[model samples]
Structure formats: C-alpha cells, structure tokens
Target: MKHALNNPYITRNFNPNNWMSDIPIIDSLSLAELVLPGAHNAGVDKKASYTALGISHWAACQNNSFYYQLTHGARALDLRLEYAVGGDGVGTFWFQHNGFRSSRSLESLIMSVIRFLDENPDEFIILDFHQLNPGNQRFDYKEFNRLLLTHLGNRLIPSTHVFLTLGQLKQASHARRVMVAAENHTELDSTYFCEYIEHEWSGIGTASVSELNVHITKVMKFPPGGSLPWSLSATSYNVAEGPVNIREHLDRWFDPALSDWVLNSNIINADFFETSNLVRHCRTANLIKANNH
Candidate 1:
C-alpha cells in the first residue's frame, strides 16, 4: 500500500545547498534538537569506478559522491574506513562497506566534504566514523587522528562545545561547519573528536514494508533528550532486493507519515537516500520544532 504524497514540507522552493541557512529558525536550535537527513554507508558509492572485494551491488549504498549528498541536504554522514597496511597504497585510508572497499581513498571523500563546507559555510555537517576496521587488522588511531586534524584543521567543532545552537556552534569554532565523531577511543583527542554517534539497526533483510515499519516505530519511541547524538537506521538489506525495490518500500511507508518520522528521530539515515524524501521531511520537521518551541 502506497502512502499519499501530499506533504506540505515536500516543496520545490527548499534549497538543498543552503537548507539550514534557508530556514532562519534552524540557526537558533541546538544540534541535538534538529532532525538531519543522513546517508548510510555514506562513502560507499557508485559515482566513481570502485574496486570491491565483495559484490558492489550488494554493498554500494549511494549513487552520488560526497559533495552531491551534502549539496542535496544530507547533514550527517555515516562512514566506514579501513587502513591499508601492506599494499602499494600503504598508510592511506579507504572507505569500506563490509568487505567492499572503494577505489577512492578516505582523503578524497574528506576533501569532498571540505569542498562543500567551503562553498556553503553556514551549513553544519556531522561525520561519524562508525567503523574503523577493528579486530580485522591493527588500526592506527594516532595516525588517523592526525590525518583528520590535518585536513579538517579549525573546521572541526570540538567535543567540549557540541550542545550549542547552530549559530553558536559555528561561532564556537570561529565559523567551523563540521564535527567529527568516532568510537570511544583513548588515543583520539577529545578536543577534536566528539562522542561517536550510536545507531539502532533494524537488523532485518525483508521485502515487506510492514516488517520495516515495525522496527521504525519501535525506534521512534526513544526519548529525544540526550548528551550523545544517535541515529535510526531506516534501511532494509536484501541482496536480491536491490536499492530500487528498497526505495519503493521506504517511500510507501514513510511518505504519508514523513513529518511524524522526522520528529521522532535525530538522524533518519537510509540507503539510496537521494531516491527518498527524507531531506524534505527533515527540513519540515525542523521548521515545525522551531515554531513549537
């Protein structure tokens, strides 16, 4: 059953490039209180030719590049990385999805974000390193942190001051537009990295939209106020059921109740995000929250 697409928030006037700045009320809200559209496995995309150890179709979550995703209203990015130790490209980091690794280096993706921030200074971005190739190989946290600081520089919003309003946060870092979140690592400097954003995975790989909705509703029950930011994984994984099919299922379930879904979750992350209405819904939810408060 498909839901009605009469959402008032789904508008043509919303500027994805400057979505946050476009909505003046958004600047006054705290980061924790805002609804952000995020890309799951954000770095794993098919825009460029990629070399994968596993099936690319099953692993690739996005079709656009990092810059495209951000310019299209995605504020949060869920990244998975693996460091190459014994290859020709030793010491360089690569974006990965399970066993599938992109031909693109982690630096390339970071540069993409940096470019977006440069173009849209008022826009805030969240970069969550959800996985760092733990247990499979010896990862270098120290070097990794160094790499981040080098590229990100003063652009990173420090962990000490992440609860401030969007305008306040930009001012705190002297107009910085990005925040980096990694797992609890002692080696990671708290001055640069904030607490890693947690996630509630639905853990289902079914074609049934009803099955997916059960998990989405359960996740919506989570209380909003918290020190650490979190995300709801709004995706279903079925190798046989490709992203096109998954996109249809998501649209059917989320379109009618888009506002409700956005209001309940901090980060509404999904695969094939470009094909979904999450960004528009998030923008509308932010406006709704601004008016209520």
Candidate 2:
C-alpha cells in the first residue's frame, strides 16, 4: 500500500509569533525582490489636544504602539518629525502627522525599536524619515543625525554599501540592521542619513474606496524593473469625510484588493496594518515570487 504524502501547509500551523520568520525562502533574494509590509505615518498612534480637526481626519493612522507594529510584521516605517528645543538649549524630536504633534516623543519610539531589534536578531528594518516641520528656525539635519546615531548605535546598516539581500544582513556581525533614509541629509558622507528609494504615494483626497481604487490601480502599473524597492501607499484619507476610521476602510475595501497590490509593489503600506492581516498577504506574495524564481 502506498502512503499519502504530507502537505506542509496542513502540517505546519500558521505562527503569529513572527511572520518574518515564515519567509525564510526569500532570505537569499535581494531586498528589491521582496515585498515588504509598511506603515504610513507610523508614529501617530495617539491624538493630541493641538491636533487640528482636518488633520485629525487622518491623524491616527496606526492604532498600536511602535513595538506592536514590528511584531505584526511591518518592516518599513514612515516617520515625519519636528525638532523640539527646550529653554536650556537641549533639543529633542517629536513625531508630526501633517501639522499636528504626536503625544509620544521620537526618542521613545526609537528606543522601542532598538529594544525590539535587540531581541529579534534575524530581522531588519527600513526607517524612512520623510517630512520635517520646522516652525520658525531651520531644521537641523546634523542634530537629527546625532540623535539617530545615539539611539540606533551599531544597529544601523551603513549607507556606504548597499544591502543586497536579507541573508547578507543576517550574516553580518551586527545581525539587526536598520537602513535609515532621511529627506534633508543629501550629502554622500552622511552615511546614516540617506535618501528614500522610489515611493509612489497616492493623495488622500478620495472620499470613498471606489475612488481610491482607481488611484491605486493607476500607480501599480510599472515598466519592468521600473521602481525596484518602491513603496505603494495602499491606505486612503479624505479630509472632507472627517476622522476616517482605517480599520473599517481596510475591511470594506483594501483587504479585498490587497493581493493584487502586493503582486505589483515591493512595499505595500497601509493604515492599521494589523487589522486586515495585511502582513500575511505581503508574505504570501513574497513566497509566490520565490517559488516562481
């Protein structure tokens, strides 16, 4: 009598502990070849008193803390910040979503990430510091670099060389690597602060998911190897709608079209990533690509 073959999908239970651990097959592939799940406005998890009504419409993009975001398989983080200075000449940083200030400080967020990376050695992260809100004074890129280095320490992957693959990063002396990309630090010597890879972000003007789908579809079409390592914003925000609940929107529309978006973009970023199992979808896309290769 012939015995039945075992199916890995049936035998291996889907582990929620770390979705990144599930995609070991793509470890040897270039970062450009993998599809990473990302969070848009990753820092704004809470609302502040000074947060304006219009800004509040899209303010709390994420509902959980930074640590939670990592655990849920978000590899890329979009951070917008403003330099905060005390009367004593000491300076700190605060997260900004549009013009509204986040209740949590930037240092707090960085510390949380450092602690997470220390525990999870095999995992790597991409930190995109995009927007800066300088009130009256000029934004200090040098000071920001100092703070980033102090917190990140040796965990940062030097911009001097490109990290081609996940396995390359895992085998390095410092297993936990973070690629930092900032908008202001343009000079080549600023290794820790580099520019972002191509990212196509759709405007948050669509009031309904149907309207938003059109924008998403248009952005997904790209020439072969056009925008390798590119990010696509899959979430939607309408200032006129007032306080758009991300969780509700994801369940209603984004979740349905997620698989197609994942196939098209290297990074598919959304609001409240944990809600609709967006990370798992991205992982599946990577798995499919690896199998085909």
Residue-wise lDDT of candidate 2 within 167-280, one digit each (tens)? 776676555478777664543236665556656755654535666667776875661254235677676666664335565544443332333555556766777787776665
Model 2 lowest lDDT segment of ten: 1-10
Top-lDDT candidate index: 1
lDDT of 1 by residue, 53-129 (tens): 44667777888789889998889999998877655545767788776777667788778888888888888888989
Error of 2 at 190 (Å): 3.3
Q: What lDDT is obtained when candidate 2 is compared to the true structure?
A: 0.65
Candidate 2 stretches greater than 4 Å from native: 1-17, 47-58, 184-189, 204-207, 223-228, 240-259
Q: Tell me the spans in candidate 1 whose CA falls farther than 4 Å from its real position.
A: 1-12, 52-54, 134-137, 205-208, 241-245, 248-259
